[model samples]
Target: MRASRPVELVCPAGSLPALRAAVDEGADAVYLGFRDATNARNFPGLNFDRDEAAEGIAYARERGSRVFVALNTFPQPGGWRRWTETLALAADLGVDAVIAADAGLLRHAARHHPDLILHLSVQGSATNRAALTLYHEQFGIRRAVLPRVLSLTQVERLIDNVPVELEVFGFGSLCVMVEGRCVLSSFITGRSPNSCGVCSPAEAVRWEETPAGRQVRLGGVLTDCYRPGEPAGYPTLCKGRFRVNDITYYAIEEPTSLNVLDILPALVRAGVAAVKVEGRQRSPAYVREVTRVLRAALDACQADPDGYRPDPEWTGALDRLSEGQTHTLGALHRPWQ
Candidate 1:
């Protein structure tokens, strides 16, 4: 959907190069996390250190783009200092906003650093207008990233009532469970995307070549077994093929990307403040291509909302980069639910 006013395009950046790619390719803002447990996507060899983050901020500011630091992970009892220090660093670096999920951390930011823009991360799990309003009123959050579990109707209604700005996922890998609340990964691996900043940590994954084919395991438990010529996906518990009622299939959700190109008009009419592309763990090249395609699509939608159609070339490019080489409307389309 072409909006009456231009909506911001928020892109992800796991590294400095990805940050540069996002801003250079027309992203209005690039979000990244520090290289620590305070942020999600705490995978090895990803994210930025203090120097790198400062460099990234400088690059974005020079390009007339904003930078958001993701201090989105919940800290454990003894780890409050890490989050607080990270927030201090972000403020010193002059970031545009901080995406945070923990209540205590939000309160701290509101009390100690009132000038910093606070954005409620999807990890906060604030799906309803009331939930969002509580965050806005309590912590003075300027925006909230909605969980990817709502239909367009629900999103539209929430936007009309919520006190703060709303950012919805435009394109990304689909999470079967509710964001920030899922514990399936934690049960299997002692790490989680919420607290430890990892889901299915690499150390917990095992791949074995079996007589039947190839077997993938998470925490040494069988998740899926793929035949020789078939595509085997990453070993996450939710996207794993399992047996139920004598059927071997994707019991939770399949490994498909979320593509909302057809629903941009509806989102625009619904008054969405921003559309976020979710791929901080992806390669810089992937970030560049995805940002470019979405930027063009949004422009095209604005040029002629009534005549807007999904560009085949754009769809093909995203599909080629998507997990399982496929994409879906996800929870945005009611039927997908």
Candidate 2:
């Protein structure tokens, strides 16, 4: 079936160049954050500062693309002012919208920046119609990005039931933790994922050679070990291979990326308002290529809904960019679901 509307292709803009890359490659909108703890993806040298954000937003708007500033992290009691300031900055800079999760912050945005478009971040953890409805009714959120844990059927049902627009992840690295409820990173690192954006903060990671293999540890806890010639993934507690019950394996979740190109038609039919490419910590080249591929695929799907099939070259390109050099449908089409 043809999409009810042309789904917005939202991409990441970690830097100015990444923003330019996505806009040039046909992203309908590009989301970013400030270079502070007020937003996620707060790794050193990753996000934008004030001047940089203004420039990036101008660059995107001039090219007919929207800019969204992510103020998605929850604020601790004393530090809440920073979050409020970030929201104000986004509005002052003429940002197209701001993606926020915290109910208090959302209320603040609605009360103070009432004209600004509000999008409930995936961190808001609204997995049901009631939650989506509540956010929409209370704060007037224009859209909500769903967490990746939901199945296809659930997404379709939510779309049918909810009044707000829905955006789902169509590409990028998969997260093992429940969205908005991450504590695994906090327990080991002495930093909450809310405050520290890095899954395994680089400074705390140590890779060493062991008699068994190459061992990668996060904050001194051995997370994964690999034999010679084995490609090690980015160190994270959830994707780690650990010795559980005498068998060393990836007991929690294996490393992989999410690619939904094959199911584009289904998403369109389900009335998805947007499909996002999730990588703000990735490189400029990564953003350019992934955005290019998805733009082409979305266009092709729109052109030939009944006959849409992913091109082989497009599949290969996305696979090369995927985590661990492979991709899956993720939870969208999971048989177990």
Cα-based lDDT for every prediction: 0.91, 0.89
Q: Please, what are the lDDT tens digits per residue for candidate 1 over residues 78-97?
A: 99998999999999999999
Can you write out model 2's per-residue Cα lDDT over 255-324, one digit (the tens) per residue?
Answer: 8888999999889888899999999999999999999999999999988889999999999999988778
User: In model 1, what is the error at residue 155, expressed in angstroms?
Assistant: 0.6
Candidate 1 regions exceeding 4 Å error are 1-5
RMSD of 1: 1.6
> Model 2 Cα displacement at 15 (Å)?
0.3
Number of backbone collisions per candidate: 2, 0
